[model samples]
Target: MAKHGFKAIEALDITYVLPTYARARVAFVKGKGARLQDTQGRDYIDFGSGIGVASLGHSHKALQKALKKSAKTLIHTSNLYYIEPQAKLAARLVEYYKRGDEGKPNTQKSDKSKWRVFFGNSGAEANECAIKIARKYGQKDGRYKIITLDSSFHGRTIATLKATGQDKFHKHFAPFPDGFVRAKDLSDIPNKLDSETAAVFIELVQGEGGINALDKKQVQHLAKILKKQNILLMVDEVQSGIYRSGEIFASKVYGIEPDVITMAKGLAGGVPIGACMTRLIDVFESGDHGSTFGGNFLSTNAGLAVLKTLEKMRKDRTLESTTKYFHTKLDSVLERYPAVFSKRVGLGLMCGLQVRSEEIFSQILSACLRHRVLVLRSGGNVLRFLPPLTITKSEIDEGFTRLLCALKELKISQTQKTAQKSKNPK
Candidate 1:
């Protein structure tokens, strides 16, 4: 049943019920740190970090300990009763958010104290909660429009999908929920605001939308406009938070404190949890929103562990320093490849390279795969690189070596094509 190096039984052993994922040639059976080992006993550098979810890297000791310990003691304890871990985790997060850069005073006041936290199971659900919050916030006076940026991505839910700025996702799901508007320019956003507009949802950096970051000046001006118009400003930090962007939240990097913020990936160091935090405290009623699995004891404990790790990183200044170091190194790499990439964008470790075309990006990705370096593509023509915050300099150097080799191979292939054409003479 083995064909050449591949096993045909391995290919046809399973039913065709599962969906295909572009069908990678290799199968990884184990992973540690930033290296993944395939079934064929090959190791690959994991620069994608499971699409930016593996913040602490594969099977981190602390995260594993927390999960195992929590699983042994208790698992699910529905939302009906009090959960100490959930309460403690919430307090820790609120404390951290209020304290800002640690030891900083609680700058968010008592009136804004009306703001609260909502938990969910994924990025999309977190965004869905945000959509509900925005809609409810506007329901008081018939406001319902949410302004999302063009080329921006929120999630795949019906509401968030509608809120997504790309038309490609709107396929087959026509007649999406109304009240979502797209604005090309930050200057043109004010015209879209009215009594019916509940909030303006924005991604400080459009992670899935080619890693296009918003201009700080434009963001500040837009925030001021929203504040003056009495409209809520919601930020989707689902992919840009948790020190992935060098800062705890992209909001901090952009210098704009949104009224509402959503987060999920890398929150629990790979555990499934999504959170929506907002400055608008009194926007929801007792029965307005709920989730069965949100803030469960196990997930909450994982969240606590993640926060503890982050606290340690912040105390040692590793989070900030690592992000800066990664950014600087990636910038250097971009400078070296100016011919292949126009520029690099993004803050901290969440960086992207603007390649010549989608085909070029795919070729680069394939080349990385061949060299055992794993990276993911974003939008159409950008390669997103989100390695673990704890990745070592040696590992980074190794990854960059693989990347350089891949680029060299691509050049050789291009040269071969040119030579072949010159010899063929049409």
Candidate 2:
């Protein structure tokens, strides 16, 4: 440790941090809408979008301007007082669900009720907020358990890690707080919920758990049942919201108006912003919960910019058509790799493929990076593609082309490995 204690560490010193992330070799130095460059100046076509945080893409002009403006004026302040940008962002999200485009809904009186939003720093924090509210809502009734679906992801925080349904995330952190349990299956939700249940949390599309999408009919059915029972229905749109799944939120696509919804990852473009929105009645009292840096001036400004950008995209219908074209291109690519991919799944830009084997999946991922096409992996096997919503049809085509080349390289490598094994007879 040196004097001037906490200065930023250089790349060589990154090992000083916790070994939480299995970081990639290359460090991106700069980026454009759908392109990125490493510190070595090597260019790459981006499909991962920084795991969906770069909604409008890296260093977008709007984001830069927003950041600069906020920095010049106010970057952060306490949440004890009202922040204009924070309130505006919350209003924008509420209005999004209340009214559709052009100030019209399917009918005059839909869910025009009030919604309150709480901001946080990341997806996990947003989810943690949701869990706390849910738990608090049941405190008087002695109901605190939350029901989450199998293979669903909440976040990495202690409360959220416990809320997550995957067993692998439960290890090495023994004794996760009580009140979180996993459902046996979608068909078993009704039976699994008990008097101790406070809420049912779901991801319309399980982004980290292989981008698995819940059935619309079953989801709506469950929502109805929960509503009648006065149980809260919560939707976690951390990876599939902010138009990533063709709609403002996949919850909108599912047509399920949940009592609570948590969103992040792409809310403020690349800026760190997470929010938990819920019905007015579901909101916690002032002393129940609060965040120190949540809804700060900077993040709220970024959020406002993102909402404005998303609204413009919706008006132009660019994301809709781009999403359609992306799926079509991915279809052609999948058709060519029948044996490597079991099937394709997902909606809008949140697409993924079911790999035939884990080896092929890893090989495909490594090849994509080597070929200058960035992507992500999910569920330990899926090749997840979550490009910026601003990606154009041509960009989608180009990215897919690069991905196809990587796929070829993977197949060739696998073939060579097979040959070597046969020769050695090992």
Candidate 3:
């Protein structure tokens, strides 16, 4: 049976579920190719894409077919034994990682080690493995510290929350795990580094941190410094990996080869799959760590389907063309509403509008929902847009139109409020 409408919320046991999120009242019942339908049958253009999870868009035929076929044959077996889809998917991901890496210099020890994959259930779990690997490798040297940047988000687990480097997320979660050194000031990060540092984890694109993309030269310089000190350069690509940034990995855009790269968001279309690859793949010896359902047959099958579909998309230049068109439209929107949104940031489909104020942000979001255009906020002030890579150009135009309509409404509403206050003269 389907969940009832918002009007019946009091009668339902909605409170039984943890109040971790302030979710909307409307419950989505169906979706298809960048469009979603609520239980009441209202249509919404899904600009959020479930926070970049639904990479193939909703109800993609290819993903559904793969899942169905896998269900009929083999859903899962214990990780105690090897699985065919699991091995195939890992091999494919390793190949994708090496796509543009050909012809590069191979003098470094990391190049000889090559990259290998470890599967997990989510981005957090993948990162957890990364932390363990870093600690294990550095244990003999007494280097256990993991450094993360301010205004960055890693995940929601206790250790990840400690590694988040945002004070707001740390509230009420006191006494976080030790060995984490948060870099509040980017310029002073080098000074903060010491012999105890094990890894410096960063996101090429800080998805929840206002869709911020660090400059390439600065990132490359930092990577060089860390390389000299033998510190692991770890990248959290959960939200920016898998051709989302006009490249297979955002790190490729910067031309930096990180020691550890973690990915999850769009890896297996909508399936829950997280992976972390390392140049030092043998860091974790047997019996050091593991998960039971990490690389089950079903999820890896989905991963294979997702990667195959991506290959086709790349051949036709679909993602690149759509992303370029979307950016052009975003430039138009910025020109139209300079007073509302200060500027635009991000690359490809992972874009953000630096909205003016929190009050205006709230009004704009409310207006968008009322008009049936669904978007998301980032870092308290950025209006984030992560529409599916498969979104049509026409849908892009329509979604931006509705977004502009919402901004216009908020502008008018605020202007009327100002005029009223001016005449009253408190």
Overall lDDT per candidate, in order of appearance = 0.80, 0.84, 0.84
Tell me the tens digit of each residue's lDDT in model 2 across 197-313. 899998999998888988899999999999898788999999999989877878888978898899999999877888998984545766777788889999999988988897788
For model 1, the superposed segments whose C-alpha errors exceed 4 Å read 1-16, 101-103, 107-112, 411-426
Clashes of 3: 0
- Residues 23-73, candidate 1: write the lDDT tens digits: 667766777888888767788888888878888888788888889988899
Model 1 clash pairs are 114-281, 115-281
Worst 10 residues of 3 by lDDT: 101-110
Model 1: per-residue Cα lDDT at residue 140: 80
What are the TM-scores, per candidate, against the unseen true structure? 0.91, 0.92, 0.93
RMSD of each: 4.5, 4.8, 4.1
Q: Write the per-residue lDDT of candidate 3 for residues 6-42, one digit (tens) a residue.
A: 5576335464766677877777888989999987888
Off by over 4 Å in 3: 1-3, 9-13, 101-113, 412-426
lDDT agreement of model 2 with the native: 0.84
What shift in Å separates residue 10 of candidate 3 from its native position after superposition? 7.3
